[model samples]
Target: MSALDKALNYSKKVGINECEIVFIKKKTTTARITDSRIVEIKHNFDEDYGIRVIHEKKIASVRTTKPQEIEKTIDLALKSASGVRPRNFWRGLPENIASNQLSGVYDEKLHKISAKETMDIAQIMINSAENSKINTITGSLNIVSENFTIVNSNGLNVEDNATYISGIINAESEQSTIPVSGIGHVSSRTLKSFSPEQIGNEAQIMCTKSINPQKVDSGKYSIIFEPYSVGELLAFVVASNFNFKTFTEKKSCFSNNFQEEIAVNQLNLIDDPHIPEGLGTKSFDDEGIKTQKIKLIENGIFKNTFSNLFDSYKEGKYSTGNAIRIGSPMGRSSEPIPSCAPHNIKINSGDRSQEEMIKNTSNGLLVGRLWYTYAVNPIKGDFSCTARSGIRIIKDGRIIGPGKSVRIIHSLPKMLKNISEIGNDQRNVIQWASLPSITPSIKVEEITVNSI
Candidate 1:
């Protein structure tokens, strides 16, 4: 029997009303440059099993890296499901989907780059940054390739995989600092698209700006966010809501606001895993179901959520191909629970130069970078963050000095509605040391800041 067939037979033999098995295998090689020196060269292999069992329409899940422990894990899941109450909302899986290719999501060179090549790239960043305006450089380059298989009793057998390579570099100075980073997205199928030097230079510029920062008074002011910062804002607005399981269970802030538009009418958020050469691209979710590019928000209206097979079954809806079985610390729960979550995310582009956005602000803060951000509530859009790599924008179009760290406390809707302009510079921000999100600079009318 195939992997899916074995999984299904195991479920039936074990008296499981329904069951699904997800298998994931991954390999990664990483290179990091520190102070013009290659500091780290590492490679890792990962594999895991995610199993779900249903009883009385209730669901319980667990993942195990040890094959020996899977039976016990399944027992725990079955017991958990049996103890819980069932709901009609436990819809069945979607019908069989024909196989389709969502290629161009991985790159081979990123994974196979020689140690010499990787270290040389890092050396370039350190040398260039130290030479360019007072700046310090820190960066990492990661090449990852993964494959996943989904098998279930319901004749659902799906398999897909992709490759991704990404890097991040930062240049900071005590004098004037503006955080800037470079990013690119392509599949192992596409090599000409990857550029490591480009990423290095972007970081160098932001770090050099740290020379002489202008200290401005703290207060509510108009603001513009750079690409990574923009991605941060969008992740808070877009990803939180799609976390349906978290929201519905009250584990997330977006749990309460189920019926509302949470962004400006001009804002559109999407998860485009199907985009050619985009990171986090996949053909099927953890459930072996075909994946899709879900438009989470359109014209500021809240659309559907991203859910895994179990969540889809629980909510009586279709799967969003958002399930990630395992990888990273949070991708798998601290406990043995199934690891399912969103992967690729893309925001529709907006057109306007950074200079134009600054000019549009009249008088406000030019936010260069954001740090120390956490969501007070994902559903409600409550956030607090610090500002760096910033400057004060006067009535004229010229740039000034640094702005103080301010607290951005507001719901997603109000915050996005305050957008006065958007930048023409769009950034691909994966491997941001967090979730991958693509974003551009955005201007907001006012943001509240408090002094230390």
Candidate 2:
């Protein structure tokens, strides 16, 4: 019998009220780049089991790498459950989960990719960023393939196969007055959609253009945020505001704005789990709940929030299939307990192209990337971030020159309402150990910038 079945039967024999076991078999290949060259390449294989047990309304969990000790792990979890407070509202685990395999979420080439092939791909990234003006290049490439299984005492059993590949390049230049850098990144589940050349070429071009940056005067100007920067905003600032728990607890800025217009009519934000090649795409959530597309903001109105089983049951609701056990580097983990998160935060594209958006701007700053982005006051919707690289000054519908770094202190509520344009150039984006988002360039009007 499989370890999962063995654990489930053992839990039942031990008189446990409920039990669930999550098993993960992961293989990862990675290449690290530094000083304009490939520095290290490594491969690792790991297996882990996470077991959760419930006795009379009390729940506990334990993780183990040794499948042979599964029964001992269950015993520990049962012992651990005795001391925990009871949750009378806790509903039982899902039973008979049914889900279809999603297309483009797994790739044979990436799953069995050799280290030499990985090095070759890394070299492509390094070669594309090579230029006399570039002083150094740094970034990483990660390819992950995982088999995830979940089984519970309620006869629930689900398994999924997934693959992920992502590459990033950061090119630095000291040819100008001060050190300036540019970034390039791409992520996909299928190798056909991944582009190492684009990653390098973009970094080279941005770094080359930002050779000599003029000072950006402090003032309120229209700002255009490219996809990467928009993804940063989505991951660090915007996403949490729609969490069901956060909203129920009155911690979200939009807590009281349900069914109200909170953004421009051109905006539509969704948590989509079935998009092709999405990093977070899967047939079901970590807890064996079938995944679905959820509209968080529909045509500017606050529509819905996402939740996992525990948080949803506490408030008499159901899971949105967002339960996740995010692993290190990338992909899912056997974390015992699952937390709620979006599958993929996607902003529906508008009709305007990026060039058209830029042409319409009379005076603006084009920001390509952001750093140290965080919410200053989440309740009040205030945020702060640094525009560190790929900044360009626009005057009379023309990009005049690159600009220096600047700090922005803005309001999310105000920014959403002031969105003037949303570009059609949507792309997949994933930040390091953060959320995955698909977004496009966004233009917001009359935002203040402080010289830094």
Candidate 3:
């Protein structure tokens, strides 16, 4: 029997009313690049098990890396449960989980990749940037394989395997004196779709374009946000506004706006977990609930919010299969308990191409990426962020020149409503410590940009 099975059986023997155990194993290969060369390669292997026990509606959880310590961990969890107050809204663990397979989420070759191979890929990326006349290239590549097993006292048992490859590359122009830089990134479930060369080339091109940048006056002006910037905005500022817990507690800006139009009539957003090769694709969520596509906004109308088991129970709703545990830096982990989070947030593509959007703009700023983005006042949909790199000014539907960093203070709801155009060129992107998203370039009208 697996550790999960043994733990569940032991919990039953100890008279625990209900329990769930999750086991996770991860293998990771990482390569760090600096100054157009491979600097280091590291390999890691980790395994951990987490157990949750419920006694008379009280819940407690414990995690441990040592298999031999499972018994002690259970005892600790039970002891912890004793002091906790019973939750009247607590519902039992999910049962009768169906076995389903998600395509493009697992690759045997990724599991077999070696440290040398990862390093070689990293080297190729650096070389590509150097060949483009970049003075410096720096980034990290991570290849991960994960194994998961879930078991509960309700006779639910399931296992899943997945692979991921992700990288970030930055390039600096050789002739630029202002320390301009560009960044590119990629994430995929298989090595076949991973492209280190494309990442490097993109960074190099952006860095070259950003040399000797000028400063634009701070004022209200139209703005174009590239795919990466859109990902940053949504992941950090917008996604949480649809959390069932936050909505139910009246802490979200959209709390009372359900079924109302909150954005442009052309806007549609979906939380999809079954997208092929998507970074967030999964067949089942952390609670062993089947995952499905959820239309968060349909034609600018707020359609639904995401919920995990606990939050759903609190609101007397069913789980949306949005239960998630924040993965470790290297990959998946069993250390954290489940919470509500988006899977793959897909902003439906629009009709206009990026070039068309740029050509049609009379005067605006194009932001390639956003830095240090956060919600200044979440309840009011107020957001603040910095456009630090890859910024360009547009004048009379022409690219004028690159611009220096600028700060933006905007309202999310107002910005969404002011969207004038959306590009069809969607790209998959994940911001730092945020959810994965697929987005395209979007143009918004009259945003507040401030000099900093």
- Highest-scoring model, lDDT: 2
- Give TM per candidate: 0.83, 0.99, 0.98
Give the higher-TM-score candidate: 1 or 2: 2
The count of residue-pair clashes in candidate 2 stands at 0
Q: How would you encode candidate 3's per-residue C-alpha lDDT over 13-84 as one tens digit per residue?
A: 999999888889999888988877888899888898988899999999999999888988998999999999
Tens-place lDDT per residue, model 2, 165-248, is 999999999999999999999999989999999999999988988989999999999999999999999999999999999999
| Model 1 vs. true fold: TM | 0.83
lDDT of model 1 at position 14: 85
Give the least accurate 10-residue stretch of model 1, judged by summed lDDT: 329-338
Give per-residue CA lDDT, model 1, range 293-344, as digits (tens): 7777777776756777667667666666676654541122112234455565
lDDT, residue 81, model 3: 95
Q: Distance (Å) between predicted and true CA of 409, model 2?
A: 0.8
Q: Best to worst by TM-score, what's the order?
A: 2, 3, 1
RMSD of each: 4.1, 0.7, 1.2
Residue 61 C-alpha lDDT in model 1: 79
Once model 3 is optimally superposed onto the true structure by TM-score, how far is the C-alpha of residue 38 displaced, in angstroms? 1.1
User: What are the lDDT scores of the predictions, listed in order?
Assistant: 0.62, 0.94, 0.87
